[model samples]
Target: MHHHAFSRRSAGIHSLPVELLTRIFVLGSQFEYLYEDSPFLLKPVQDYSPAEAPNLQVIVSHVCRHWRQVALRTPSLWTTLHFRKISHIQRATMYLSRCSLSGTSNTYLLDILIDTVAEEDYLPGINLYKNELRTIFQAIVPHVRRWRAFHLKICDDDCKAQARQYLSACGPAPSLETLQLYHFTDYRTAQRLYLATYRPPVIVFSNTLPRLKNVSLIGVNLPWDKSPFLQDLHHLELALHLDNIRTPYAYWDRMLRLSPELRTLCLHYSGPKEATAADPALIWPNLDDKIQLRSLQELSVTDLDPDYLCQVIQRLHIPNVNKLTLDLPDQNFTPFVELLTNSAATGSTDNTGRASNTQASSRFHPMEHSSPSTTPPDSPILSLRNLETLIVRALECSPSSLISLLRATQALRVLQVDFSRVGGGLCQIFNQDPGITPSAASLASTGFVHHPLLPLLKIMKVAGTPGKDILNTLHTRHRLSREPPAVSEKWIIGWDEKRRGTDAELDALVDKGYWSFTGQGRKVRVIIETYDDEEEVEEVPDNDAESGDDDELEDEP
Candidate 1:
């Protein structure tokens, strides 16, 4: 019986055509390498040995003679090459040789990733020397014309200099589509290095990389004004540069103008330098003529100066943006709040800076406060009507200001807020009966009365211990008789020695069925997660009360 089953399996394997087998091999290789999610550079750098080169191709080729023949004919499977360790040199060469055996005049394009550390901090004894690095580059430099994406990550200053020297002279890359250069160093060290050895910007590619559509540079500076590589990009990420070495607003404006089709822009502690009285000219060209970014869909600005962030927001028009993430650590939220509230007064400006008459009448105007001196009566709130997901961290603002911001996002579907980092009274806005609570009543008197706060919201995620306000909010939403009655809520609580008894309240809520379905036949799913000192605790399963099965809650440590 075993022999007959093996015979049937072998026959089924051989029945597939060579083209289909090759295609399967290609997809398997890509999945092993995570080809679609290439350039995993945003993650924190770790001092570990390089991952073993994916052996999927080699393993399949050794399965049988027929599989070997099919794998040998597929060149695209070997296009992704990584050279992070000394042993990888041999593997890279073998992959390149296989790509050359396609029997075609034009070889397949290459997606290369070079990640290395200095000799002193080498992994175990496998130190990647400068000569070895240069040799690897020399081999790939010949195929620069067929380069599809290049990612370079260096850990120390010496390796950074070596990489810059080689890349500066690599010449024009006609087929290069994505370029990412990251100097991986600790935050303090990077800041010190930039301040100590500040120098004029250097040009990397003398010829414009015409096809380059994505560029990410961290702790690296380029001639922003003259670099042709910054034009027509679809995604741009810049971070960790010191203020003195940062580009001014004019350079950023120029790059935005050149990349009209840019879809994603992320600035982390890096953007136009802040304006000061000593150099007032830095805020040049009259920001009144805002740059229109109609194609921008995702925007993230973190650890930025409030004035600089306000200037950046005021100088652009992102009408179609759907995702926004902001980290506000400062107490001065006036500038940001004013921007959010006054956007509607700009006459509903479109991407072309033309005022549309249709939305002018529908603009949001806050109600008159009893004390007119404290409120801006005619101020129009910004219409972030298209925003669907918002993640706010370390936001310090008044409850009224937070209400105003939430009021603008009528179409929000997902909201994630770190309650530990947020100011007090912001969480109370979720309570259904606003007239009874002072904070909620104050928010209601504002623009929140016309419509519910984020009525279309489907998922609300909060980080911090669960509180009565959050429980009340959940209870109120779940009891509603509306079509979209309730939202799925998740609470992330941090456990520590001092905070051992904090979960008692949450435990009581679960026992009282506050996280279960309401009498109205609407269900509210609640997820409770705990972590201790950045170490994740075991995740509890989602409590789906719809089944009427009560699961006992585990005590968090």
Candidate 2:
């Protein structure tokens, strides 16, 4: 039966054209590379999971003779070359050989990742793995000119020294576009050793590698003055622990001006000091003061002071920015409010449409549209019309401020209200206080105090546990409103709370019909489901690319 089933499945699958099958195999090979469920790069080949055991090239080849021939001919399926342990050194060479086969183009770009440094801590005598690093470097060094994206992450200083020497010897990488050279040790402790020995050559391409774009540097020192690596970057991340060699704000301004096509900018402990002279674009007294990030769409700043973050935000003119993540020392929503409001008012970007003139229905009362006094005079007073997703981790703002923000962002569709770290202020907004039984009719009578809270809010995902008062408020809001904007019984009430064991209230709502509509002659469907934290993980900042002391603000745009 098993043999017959295999034959039936394989018969139809084999009928697909070789071109389509090759594309499928190419995508399958990159399964480990794209979605990183495991740290396969850090582990040896033998330690790979069963899913990753039979790589794309191997899995397709195992099907049949014709499949094996097609897989062998597909050069793209062999582009990625990963080197880790001593046993894999030969495998790296063989893969590169296949990548450079006669059938493929001579200029087929290669994506190389060399992590041969000792995974464990390096002691005095036990550090005999230098040979492994040298072996891998020698095997992969000759093919540097064809590198499309080169990632060298060495934990040991000696390994980095060898790798740096090899990289310097290669001179100009004409095809190299993305470069990530990281010394995976605490920058503070290893500062002395790095300054003494690891003096890498200034990355001057001399008209080579003009297409270079993304670069991520961590604890790796390079002379920025003469380096072409700093130019034409679309996405750049710099997280060096050296306080003395920190790139000043003026330098950052110059760098930004150089990279006109830059889209994504990430800064972690990489900003200039507050006391330093402000950039030309940020000099407030100047008649024309604006930093036009024409192409910038996404930005991530972590571990910087609130003042610095605000200064940076005020300076940048990201008209197309739709997603923003603020991971500051404190949850100060003032800057966010000012930024979003200004972005909406200006309508500088084509993405943020002008606010609709249609007035709110009888469900809410009209109030004065008051913005923070700190906002610039010329700043627009519109909602964050383009912003659809917002993730707040360190939520420490008042309910009034939170509600004010919600009202301003009429186009917001999804909100992840994280209250895991802070106190229970979020709970107070949703769950009216103990003695205060704020009825739905009373809430409706008053209408909306300010602008209606979350007019377009379709999903509300709370990180921590919500109280009975909060749940009741949502129920009442849905029940009272004649046309409850977007809320429906079938609408989702996603819970991402990390508390152990099932809640009695939740179980009652699920098992029995706890949601009651007494005498109203109405029924609603509130489908409760476990919220996957993976959706929120993108908002967090990359710790490896950012400062070690910085908190995580996982976000994606």
Give the winner by lDDT: 1
Per-residue lDDT of candidate 1, residues 406-486 (tens digit): 777878988878777776443465542364533434544653332346777866666664656666565455443233333
> Model 2, residue 179: displacement in angstroms?
2.3
lDDT of each: 0.64, 0.53
Candidate 2 lDDT tens digits, 1-557: 99999888878977789899888888787766632432212211112211222255755665567787777678777776655434345555656766788856456787776654443654433222567777776776677677787766766666766766676676677787877666654335667465533564444334366668877766555665556457777877665435445554445555666776887776665554233223432222110123556677566565665544544555455655555554444545444444455444542211112222222222212222121122343343222566676666554444555555656666777766566543344545543342454466686687733222565776666655544544565554455444454543332333435432456564444344435342355665555555544252232222222222111212211
Task: After the best TM-score superposition of candidate 2, give how far the Cα of residue 331 lies from its true spot, in angstroms.
Answer: 7.6
Which residue pairs come into collision in candidate 1?
Answer: none
lDDT of 1: 0.64
Error of 2 at 199 (Å): 5.6
